[model samples]
Target: MPELPEVEITRLGLMPLINHKVSQVVIRNSSLRWPVNLALNSILKDMPLVGLQRRGKYIFASFPIGTLIIHLGMSGRLCIASKKSAVQKHDHVDIIFNGPENKILRYRDPRRFGSITWTEDDPYQHKLIMSLGPEPLDNEFSADYLYEKLRNKSVCIKNAIMNSHVVVGVGNIYASESLFQARVQPHRPAHKISKDEIKSIVDAIKDVIENAINKGGSTLNDFFDVDGKSGYFQNEHHVYARKGMPCYLCDHPILQITLGQRSSFYCKNCQK
Candidate 1:
């Protein structure tokens, strides 16, 4: 699934659509994770895209009528396609822009797990986004906040960080990388971690996420940018998916375990 960095990249890629009026909306299929609003055509026609923003793994396209919330669940990708471009399989929806170039924003999802929804209310207060914790890259996700959130939690450290309510956008891959960077064992209980270690974890998460964004996000599976380009951050991973492989730091073999039903990788000798 595309995480925060990937979602942010998509949001950035869609910036050109801002200030452009929607000419038409073509929905080939409405059977996604949630039924796409069938009235999208009428709702968005002639509406200018005012802005594009990202929160967690969701992208918000702001317009006068409302906000279009998009989630690239699992294998979904949004790409810029020309009007003349051929429609390929899995091309579920298209938002044609009213411009000389006649550009189109196409959504393709092989698994059909992604969603496109509309909300006329403040998007931040939308039910899907209301309870989400502070973004990991924001100052609001400080060590003090995270320390308090986990003070009484018995969940594994990996699971704790992966919880969206604790801090948003730290997915499975980033969770392992962040913990490895912090030299914290993934299986340790969240409350058992020292305050100093929590601070390190906080810093590591920000650094890891920022670096991943710079690298275009990890392309371990079907994730790609709006230009159909793959991210190179997976090449820089420390322990994610390197199970049984040698650790880059201590040379001890990287170990893998399952926490919260997700695969977690860590260096036993280095991460304690």
Candidate 2:
């Protein structure tokens, strides 16, 4: 699935469409994770795209009529294509913009797990967005807030951090990488972690997320930028997916365990 970093990168890549008016919306396949809103063409016709923003893993394309909420579930890719570009298989939706360039914001998903929805009210108050925790890179996700949230939870730190209510966008890969960076074992009970350790975890989360965004997000599977570029952050991973590889800091082999039914990797010696 495309995580927060990848979503943010997609938002950035779509910035050029900010002031473009929607000429039409073409839905080749409406059967996604959620049905693509069939009225999108009429609702968005001639509406200017005022802004594009991301909350957690969802993208909000703001317009005068409403906000277009997009979730790049699992294998979804949102790319910029010209109006003349050939529609290939899996090219499920197209938001065509009115301009000399006639650019099309194309959404392609092989798994059909992505969604496109619309809302006329405040997007933040949307059912999907209302319950999400603070963005990992936002000031609202401070160490103090995290410590308070986790101080009473007995859930394993890995699962706790991955909770959308506790903190959004800390997916499986990022959870493993961030925990390894903070030297916190994924199996540690969240309530037993010290305040100092919580601080380290917060910093590590921010650093790891920001670095992933800078690198265009990890492309371990189907993730890619708008230009179809693969992320490079996987090259710098210390523990994630390095199951039996020797730890860089210590020669001990990195271990892999299943937490919350997801693969987790850590250096036994380096990540106490």
How many residue pairs of model 2 clash at the backbone? 0
lDDT of 1: 0.88
**Clashing residue pairs for model 1:** none
For each candidate in turn, the TM-score is: 0.95, 0.94
Go through the candidates in order and give the clash count of each. Answer: 0, 0
**lDDT (tens digit, per residue) of candidate 1 on 151-267:** 899999999999998899999999999999999999999999999999999999999999888766344223433445533345578999999999998899999999988999999
Q: Can you tell me which runs of candidate 1 are displaced by over 4 Å?
A: 217-227, 230-232
Steric clash count of candidate 1? 0
Please list the Cα RMSD from the true structure of every candidate, rounded to 1 decimal place: 2.5, 2.6
Write model 2 residue lDDT over 110-197, tens digit each, in one string. Answer: 9998889899999999999999999998899998999999989999999999999999999999999999999999999999999999
